[model samples]
Target: MSVDPVEQWSGVLDRFEADIALAVSGGEPVPWNPPVEAEAGPLPEELADRARRILDAQLESMAMLGKVRNDALAHLDALSAVPDSQSSAGPLFLDVQG
Candidate 1:
């Protein structure tokens, strides 16, 4: 028996939702099932709209993660650029008269 298009879309939506939830939970990485345009193209308007919304949320999440990764790398680079304190013969902190 052929699967109903609506049912197929629902299944896809369900998987995406679960994966999104897993991502937010900080759980193990999801084997994300991104929607394929060929399969999604024939979906009914309402279901397609739902899929688009999910895709948008995923895109936002990915952009956020990219920003966070870049920020973390920048911090690491900053720390690495700091000169090693051990190389100096001077005391670690200069006593401020304040």
Candidate 2:
């Protein structure tokens, strides 16, 4: 079976993102980083445009992730509201008078 081009591209981008994040977080050294050079070019205008697009895409992805998390949490809360016999035990009583 052949891999989808979009899936392949996404894997590459995910690796690039992880490497950048690691360098930024100090898990990897910044000085010898290769991504910096990969992004650098003599054409500043084109690079700037590409950077803006990448940032916009990343922001959208984050927003979608947040929405998914919120939806999942709301579902969990709704389920939690329904009391289960295993979870509904009587209040604790201490035998301090014994």
For lDDT, the strongest prediction is 1
Q: Over 4 Å off in model 2, which ranges?
A: 1-43, 87-98
Instruction: Give Cα distance to truth, residue 57, candidate 1, Å.
Output: 0.5
Cα lDDT tens digits, model 2, 18-57, are 6556644447433533334333323344245544655676
**Could you tell me which residue pairs clash in candidate 1?**
none
The TM-score obtained by model 1 is 0.65
**Model 1 lDDT, full chain set:** 0.79
The 0-to-1 C-alpha lDDT of every candidate, in the order given, reads 0.79, 0.57
Please write out the lDDT profile of model 1 over residues 1-98, one tens digit for every residue. 65667877788888887777677666687566566767654777778778898999889778877887899999999999988998977788877996
CA error at residue 30 for candidate 2, angstroms: 16
Superposed on all Cα atoms, model 2 deviates from the true structure by an RMSD in Å of 12.5
Q: List the residue pairs that clash in candidate 2.
A: none
